[model samples]
Target chain A: MADPAYRAAGEGALRIEPLGELAAIFDRRSQQTHLVTQPMPEILAALAAGPCDATTLAARLADSFDLDGEGDAAAILAERLDELAAMGLVEPV
Target chain B: MSTIRTLVDLLAGRRDAAALAPREWDGVIAVARAEALLATLAHRLSGAALPQPVAQLLGDARAAAAVATAQAMWEAEMARRALGPAGVHFVLLKGAAYAAADLPCAPGRQIGDLDILVARDALPAAEAALLAAGWEWVKEDAYDDAYYRDHMHELPPLIHKLRDRMIDVHHTIIPPTARPNPDAASMLDRAIMLPNGYRVLHPFDRMIHCAAHLFADGDLAGGLRNLWDFHCLTRDFQARGDCDSGTPDGALGYDEWLGDMGYRAKLWGLGPAVRRALHLSAALFGDEADYRRLSLGDRLFRARLLARDDWGRETRPLLRLAFYIRSHWLRMPPLMLARHLWTKWRKGRGAAR
Candidate 1:
């Protein structure tokens, strides 16, 4: 099956506070605070802007960061997106 | 004079840092920070052609204020959700209310706690729901708990067990013993409900409550920020055509609808103090006649409002005490006030010992 398109739960619903490499996000909908790291923050920001599939998000992330050519960045991003979805920070649009 | 006046003018949009001396900026920033108004000052002074140093100072304060405000918003939302399941509708009050309603006064404003006003009858249920949701009463002292239940307008505050944030659930704006006894029912009837199911006081009632809170409730220690709230709420409501225009007779024209609320003297006193603090004229608040009646009181309040040193310490300690006594006097009967003061003093002395 094709990977489902993902997007942030809603605009302005998450309050993110970055402390060095780690960040805290307070989800207004679930009233949950989640501590996230590195590429997750970038991923959330991208999804918050608008919905896109893993391929599109991977492309954007590749441009923003230096990715190793040995492995598939899209699969890594898809795994991270699933974890975020489980946390209720993002949803399949 | 330069510090307070410059800060006021900056907030009123009448002046910018270009007109202030380098030495004055330090005092101005100090006073603003002391009064918990640094963020508000920062927000107001944004986009002005301020000196680079002043701009940086405001930027840092604004960023800090934004974080504090965001945390406050989260607490308020938590309170709303906790109380929602019990079918209790509560009205957000003061700083929390301003932020929740997205009022103009909210940007960069500092909120210390989450305050919500529920109907007196629903308070028990509301309290139960909050407790069930992990909020615990903050006061454990027997006397303080009794005092809150018997004399105060609100319950002893509750703190979220997990978050360590405080919430004050008030049933009314003022103590039940206060002489004015504002119509809580009327005020509640006029509350505006937001899409999120949270309610806020009507513009007129909110303004009156702010005036009463500053002039009659406590020592005027935080009067500057309270007065700013009054100014912002009035300006916001007037711009929206939500408030009645004052009369030409100059007899506190705004009091036409407010006269029956029974706090005319207190409301009248707030007019001149706010005017003096913001460098505004009597005409701005529509209480020239009332201002004339309370001119001496106005002078006293203005002095207290401006008597703070750069560090926000009272320059005139005696004057501060006098106003402190005056606030208690306004809140209760003479005998009750004396008795209450004695009890508090004794308790404090015992604690010290």
Candidate 2:
């Protein structure tokens, strides 16, 4: 199967503010604020730059932060993208 | 750079931090803070190489503004949720709208209060919804409350009991009696809806509303910030070619928009206020002829706006009072003004006792 391409739901509509370990994202589209920790913001930032599939996103994430080698990074990124999509933060492009 | 000139230049996006002396930073910051433009100043000066202390001060201000803006967004959401069930879709106004829409004038802007507009008929339902959701009338005096309902454009300001944030729910840009009774329905119909389902005034309506509010409604105490809003919004619209486009069907052109909003006479005062504050007029009013014709009112507004001393104290108290009287005069007829001032004076004396 082709890798699923993912994009942020409201690209320009989200305003992100980092608060220590957590980040606050205000979606102007939904008018709802979501607080997320770690790789979620990193993931969103990546998608914000441009749309990318899970394999490409995992490679992008690996370039920035240390990832555990025990698990497949592509699988981990795909799971994270699923969570983000459910939260209305991202969608399949 | 001269401190006032530097401040104006910075706001106009013509960066020249190299020429500023260390001693002048304190005065410039003081003036900007007093005018509630510190956040805007911080926003403009961001990323430009500056003295360490100046950069740090602006950084801190910008951080604080970001937090406030987030809180404002949350508050707006709460308002929408509370009012939406009652079929009330409120129109966000001023700073809140700017921030919500992510307009150019929004970054680093400080919102003092949340202002919204609803159809006059929906006001009662809107107020009830807010009150039921913990918003309380900020004014306790019966006469003041009555005055707001009977004569003003908005309800007495309300405060969230738990959040302690104030919200002004207005029905029209100006009081019906004060201006030519602008077509509130037309404005509401033409509002631009944001992705969040909230709406803001159309760009043209927004500009005229700011002009009217600054020049016709109040005593110009915070006129500088308001005029900057006028300048930025108008310029943005012009740059986008929105102003140059032919008038939308059933909508007024720029000149007619001003007149319909009851800013025709006040624009005379506002024109000079903008020119004096920013030292630029061509971009704002299109031509110098319109501004030149309004020089007399411009002088009055300019004196009032620029009267503050180094410490931000009004240097020309009499001129300020004259402007204050002028604002009241513009708001009501002579007889009503006399009665209103008398009542306010009596209330002040009673409170002193």
Docking band of candidate 2? incorrect
Model 1 lDDT tens row, B188-283: 887877765678887667777787787768888878788888788766664553422232222334545344322432444444333343332221
Off by over 4 Å in 2: A1-93, B241-294
Worst 10 residues of 1 chain B by lDDT: B280-289
lDDT tens digits, residues A1-93, model 1?
477788776777889999888999887655579999988889987776689988888777777788775248887888899778656577666
Residue pairs of candidate 2 with colliding backbone atoms: none
DockQ for every prediction shown:
0.07, 0.04
List model 2 lDDT by residue over B1-353, tens digit each.
33544566667666477567786787778778887888888998888878899999999999988887877876787687578778897899999998877777788888878899999999999999989777898879998898899899888999988667888899987876674456677778878887757788887677767767787677888777777787777666645534222345224455554344334323433432223433323322233313344456665675566565555455688888888887888788788888888999999999999
TM-score of 2: 0.71
Listed per prediction, chain B TM-scores read 0.86, 0.85
- Candidate 2 lDDT (Cα, whole model)? 0.74
